[model samples]
Target: MSEPHAGSCRCGLISAEASRAPFWTSYCHCRDCRKQTGAPVMAFVGFRDEDLTWHGEPRSWRAGGVERRFCGYCGSQIGYSDDRLPGEIYLALGFMDEPERYPPALHAFEARRLPFLHIADDLPRYSGFSVER
Candidate 1:
């Protein structure tokens, strides 16, 4: 059976479920990503817009040419969507119930990676957007 995947915000007030698997997953090291996640890097999984469902209202704002969504109650980031990539929704890996199941296959915005941060894995690295690089 295809076990569905689930996730929630820090306060558990914002929850979501994915009926199908994601299309791609990656670790992003861009300055915007770091600032949004408040981490050295941000991990995300991309799913078709139709495959995911949300349980609560999320506040959103435009940043770096994309719409960033987060839980209004807990200030937890929920996901992001780019106008250029229609039909796709990217979600935070940390919020996933089983984040390990969606290991990042590549690192995006490698050029922006912090000088002090280093990812030990040898996964493919892209200087910019993985899909474009």
Candidate 2:
């Protein structure tokens, strides 16, 4: 049996646990994600609703009509839930322990990727997200 995956906010106020490994992982370069995360690119792990649980109330806000949650005290991003991907929550990979274990398999919104950042990898780059997810 595998152990549940875990993550916590910088201030340790918000914590999360997933009963199973993520089904999808990717890097997003959309403007909304950039602005919200204060990064050129953002990595996320997609977990099913039934497999994930939260331990604290994370502060939430909407941008581009999508809901994102984060720790209010430390501003550590927790994740986002998109209506387009119903029953899935995309959590910020940076907050997870040993994040190297959940490497992103592809890049999303590649057209919007900032010029200053370069992720030289052969991973399939998508102008948008993969349809299968």
Candidate 3:
């Protein structure tokens, strides 16, 4: 088996590893993401929920229909789970040990995207949500 990609929270109370590389990387520009991240966009990596293992139990909160998890000590946003996307997990890119390794392949919620943030990269951009190529 290949080496897993490891990550941890700021306080070291929460850590995680993925058996495989991320299935997808994306930048979300929705209002909810911006408010949560306190940034113009929020970066995330998608993987099978079962593929991710945590070293410690994380604190969870419900936002809409999703369960957002974070380190209770450091308040680092770690990841999230949603019943709408069974068998999959969404990890906050900021929590990655090597965040630069995961470049966003797509931009979502562009309709509500902040006007001050300019993304010059050539990755595909979408107005809202999308589930297909």
In TM-score terms, which candidate is top? 1
Of the candidates numbered 1 and 2, which has the greater TM-score value?
Answer: 1
Clashing pairs in model 1, backbone N/Cα/C closer than 3 A: none
**Backbone collisions counted per model:** 0, 0, 0
Q: How far is candidate 2 from the true structure (C-alpha RMSD, Å)?
A: 1.6
lDDT of 3: 0.85
Model 1 lDDT-worst window of ten: 124-133
What is each predicted model's overall lDDT from 0 to 1? 0.90, 0.87, 0.85
TM-score of 1: 0.94
Better of 2 and 3 by lDDT: 2
lDDT value for model 1 = 0.90
Residue pairs in candidate 3 whose N, alpha carbon or C atoms collide under 3 angstroms: none
Candidates in descending lDDT order: 1, 2, 3
Query: Positional deviation of 103 in candidate 2, in angstroms?
Result: 0.4
For residues 1-133, write the lDDT of model 2, one tens digit per residue: 2766988999899998888999989999998889889988999988898987788889999865579999999999988988777888889998787688899999999999998889989999999865454
The deviation in Å at residue 130 for candidate 3 is 3.5
TM-score of each: 0.94, 0.92, 0.93
Cα lDDT for residue 27, candidate 1: 96
